[model samples]
Target: MMTIVVSVLFARSTRSTFPSDGSTSSLITHYLAGAAIASGVIVTPPAVLALTTYVLAPSLRHLFERLLLYPLFGAAALVFLFLAVTTWKPGPGTPTSNMDTAASLVNAAAASALATSGIIVTTTGILASNFWLTLYFDARRCHPYDHIVLFLLGTAAHIRRERHRWHDDNQVTIWRASLEVVAVQVERDAPLSGRTGLAEGSAYMELRQEARRIAAVIRSHKRDLAEAYSAHDVDAVVASLVVGLRAFCVGDRTALLAHAPAEVAPRVGRFARTALRLIPATVLIVAGILLPLVPSIAHSELASNLRWYLIVMGTITFITTREDLATKIGEAVAKVLLK
Candidate 1:
């Protein structure tokens, strides 16, 4: 029953053309359904690849740890072989009754082998590639996805102030650590969380409380915080100086900024900075949403391809920009849910 329901949902989801003639509520429903479907499609491969690696890692740890791309290449070879077998067709021929019967049995066996091999090889290749890339990035201690995390969890307020600070030496680390610290505070004070909107009340209050906490921490280690913030790169411990400090309140912001140079502060307001960060993602989203509406492109394979391309590009833009899109979403949601 559940499987049938899910299948129906996915089937309906794929047919969505984002019709422009719909009522407002209908349009919203369609958009949300389409977005949900897209998110599932986008996330499924990575989830499967991760699970495959985890299940195989214990037995094949050495192979992945050392061989890396060699395993991926071997997997690719298997995939090519599977494809070759599946596509190979019997040549034009005439045969007796005995030959026909024998050929049918042979073909059945071949079909079974192809089906089994295709699944195994495809999954192996996907997991091998994912694991190799993960190891490659891990060795360098730099994960680009961290930028996405920063954007998702960051408030528009913080992104507005620290937009320029992103990707700088120790900047990602600083923000990540700060978020962890704030998360700890939120968790500890879970009972005290506001009854109103999650962000407007809870997150806002937490940011203020965090500001005071950071101010105290800085007072005792002013020189240390200053030196780390001003340096090109900071170690793990110092890197977590909480970038949120500067955005929470004027006093804390001033104290934290005192150590850094005057030129480091952003010149624009929060809304302007947030808008700047959103441009690429917004453009891609707009293009994706509107491309299929063109009469010339309607129902064509090119339209489908371009829409997927735009969707992927837009998603990448959102990821690369550190989730400015999500911040906007949170802000919008908070407004509706405000007490």
Candidate 2:
């Protein structure tokens, strides 16, 4: 329930950043990608167990034995709901002054496409979160296995560059320019009129659409910074948060200053924020690891009753700690192994 709710919230918040041409094909591509990620997440636990058992020690052999006991695979159904709520940005020359019939249709389709991609990302993350919980609890329930899946999904979603094209300096420049143009337009108050009425190729119209695109980009940037904060990426947070006071020109500095809220200033310390986020998951994972050592509670009736509860808690924490230190650890291990 919480997973679905969070998925919807995350999708809606970040849907505007997806690159779409307001076409059906673009939306379909995102949906397909989402499905692929979700499918991979679902099967990853068992696949990891099998591969690890064969290559490494057979310590996870018992996990495969108890796989059927817990019902841990049903998050794909809520994906469509998340996608349907997505809001996409329109084309470059979309007119905001007067709503044209063709422009409206284009905007609507673009919105749907944008929404689809956002929903796809959200659904994939949630499914991955579920996989993390399953791996953690399966071990706790005496089907112990390593959490390789968490690192894999986290690296794909948070660390990788190709997956998030908008997180670039060039893109940030475009966003700032678009926003400044729109700001100047709004300040003018008058329409883009000439000798007669409105101009045929009004610059305001293009700027308006560009502004919409920039708004989405800013929202996505803030989200990226927040995730970086959670993951204790202090350098990233500082670089992104502290928008330089000095710009090449006075206009440029004013425009940058206007984007303070969008830049999302750092409040809490990165280490403190990360520690807080990890505490619950750490306690859950640690308890799961150490519980079996104490034989009295390991097989007692109390343990049996709390087993389901603990699993539920573990799943919630897994979703909450989406891209914390665990992701960095996973990436480090991967680099070492690859070498």
- Winner by lDDT: 1
* Candidate 2 least-lDDT 10 residues: 143-152
Our model 1 lands, by Cα RMSD against the true structure, at 20.3
Give the clashing residue pairs of candidate 1, or none: 151-322
lDDT of each prediction vs. the true structure?
0.45, 0.42
TM-score winner among the candidates?
A: 1
| Clash count in backbone of candidate 2 | 3
Where model 1 places Cα greater than 4 Å from the true spot, the runs are 1-191, 194-289, 296-339
Q: Measure candidate 2: CA RMSD.
A: 29.0
lDDT of 1 by residue, 1-339 (tens): 234333433443343333333344544543455344433433455455544543433222223333434443454345435433343223457355344433433333343343333444455656667877886776466332233233324533353356456446465545544444343332322223333345677665654454344433433332333345433333322333444333333233444435533222112433344456568778987897898889988777567666766666666666655567656754554354431
Candidate 2 stretches with Cα past 4 Å from truth are 2-22, 54-62, 65-339
TM-scores, in order shown? 0.23, 0.20
lDDT of 2 by residue, 222-299 (tens): 445434423335245334423321221122424533543333232243335545766876686667556745788787
